[model samples]
Target: MLQVNNIEVIYMNIIQVLRGVSLEVGDGKIIALLGANGAGKTTTLKAISGLLKTEEGEVTDGSIVFDGKRIDRYGPVEIAATGITQVMEGRRVLGHLSVEENLMVFAHNRKDRKEVKGDIEKVFEYFPKIKTLRRQTSGYLSGGEQQMMVIGRGLMARPKLMLLDEPSLGLAPLLVQEIYEIIRRINAEQKMAILLVEQNARAALGIADYGYVMENGRVVLSGAADMLKGNEDVQEFYMGLSVAGSKKSYREFKHYRRKKKWVT
Candidate 1:
């Protein structure tokens, strides 16, 4: 399990980006962090995974705890080795490397060659298509394939928790559904925990056990996924759906949410 407690983040030690943002992911559960652009969803992930310093961003307040220990000061490599891996927003594969080679890079530090091979086979089990492209250049794979490959690479780490940012970003709807299915399977079968940050609210909430909605760098609303889904404000703002399938005027929707009454 992971806990982020009242954490504030700042960039260049000047501009504050996350204002007391907090959330949690329990063992074998999926938690969705949903918001529009500039809402600090990614900032929260960077804070947890210790990637903040790379961009001159730092956690200025509170703490991030993994399992039971504080992990706020650790570097990304140390964080990854602690059974947490981040699949960033962009699919960043080594373009020149073959798919298998790209995956091997994550497992390269381990001395157990047979275990590494079995892990690769396990990835293949979840992603049969990746097997065919094992020797092919990663740069040449389709966007959906590249996305699968990135998640497959994360699996090579055998993480207890996976920080997933925008996993369904540019893929087709069918592919998005397919990927979510596999994600659910991994959480169930592998006992993996996922902290999913996404702008694709519906898809994320569909699979998440709990959901948090952020606005202007703070958590405004959070609850059980089903409760958040049924919330009128969440329905109008994040979901783009309304009661009885009737559409509300843009002005009316804004007025309802901007009051912030629902959040209180």
Candidate 2:
């Protein structure tokens, strides 16, 4: 469980990136944060994961409460040790390390050596392709494969909450579908709580239990994923479509609004 209160983050020279953004993720539920670029989606994730440096971009207000503990002031390593791990936007993997070695790197902080091996096996079981490429260098893997490896490494951290930022970005449609399927499986079967930041609204909402729409660093809407899926504003602004079965097409609607000066 996690609660991000009305937290604010100001970058260098007081550039306010997160404007009192707030949201919640229930235990084992997938909560998707949908927004365009620069809506502070990634900033929210970094703040929660303790990757935001205090001296540069401070948490000017509010709190980040995770599993009954305040973690706003904690560092990234401390956050991981507290059962929170992040799979960032780029899916950063250790380029020189082998697949198994990358998984092993995360286990240094883990106390259970026997369980570590079993846990690595569990990752391999979830990502069977990783097993086949166990000895291969991560730098040589394809983008989708590298994403899987990053996610596998996160799993090795034994996270209570996984913050996945744009997991489907830059991947092919088929690979996106496959990765999403794995994400769904993790949330449903493994009961892993996920905070998903994605521009792929259709797919993210398709798999999410609940959704939040952020605009200009503030949450504009929040509801059950299905409900938000059918919302008119969500469809028009975010999904780039008019209301379902409307006589006026999206282009026609936009033209009319523009003519009337209803849209700038």
Give me the candidate number with maximum lDDT.
Answer: 1
Measured with C-alpha atoms, the lDDT of residue 90 in candidate 2 is: 93
Show the colliding residue pairs in model 2: none
- Clash count, one per candidate: 0, 0
Per-residue CA lDDT of model 2 for 88-200, tens digit only, reads 89988899999999999988898899999999999888888779999999999999999998888988888889999999989999999999999898778778899999998
Residue 51 alpha-carbon offset, candidate 2, angstroms = 0.3
Instruction: Give the alpha carbon lDDT tens digit for every residue of 1-264 in model 1.
Output: 799999999999899999898888999999999988999999999889888888999999999999998999988878878888889998988999999998999896677888999999999899997899999999999999999999999888888999999999899999999999999998899999999998888899999999999998999999999998888778877777765446656665454434445443
Q: Which residues of candidate 1, in runs, are more than 4 Å off?
A: 245-264
Evaluate candidate 1 by giving its C-alpha RMSD to the native, one decimal: 2.5
Please report how far candidate 2 places residue 98 from its true position, in Å: 0.9
RMSD of each: 2.5, 3.0
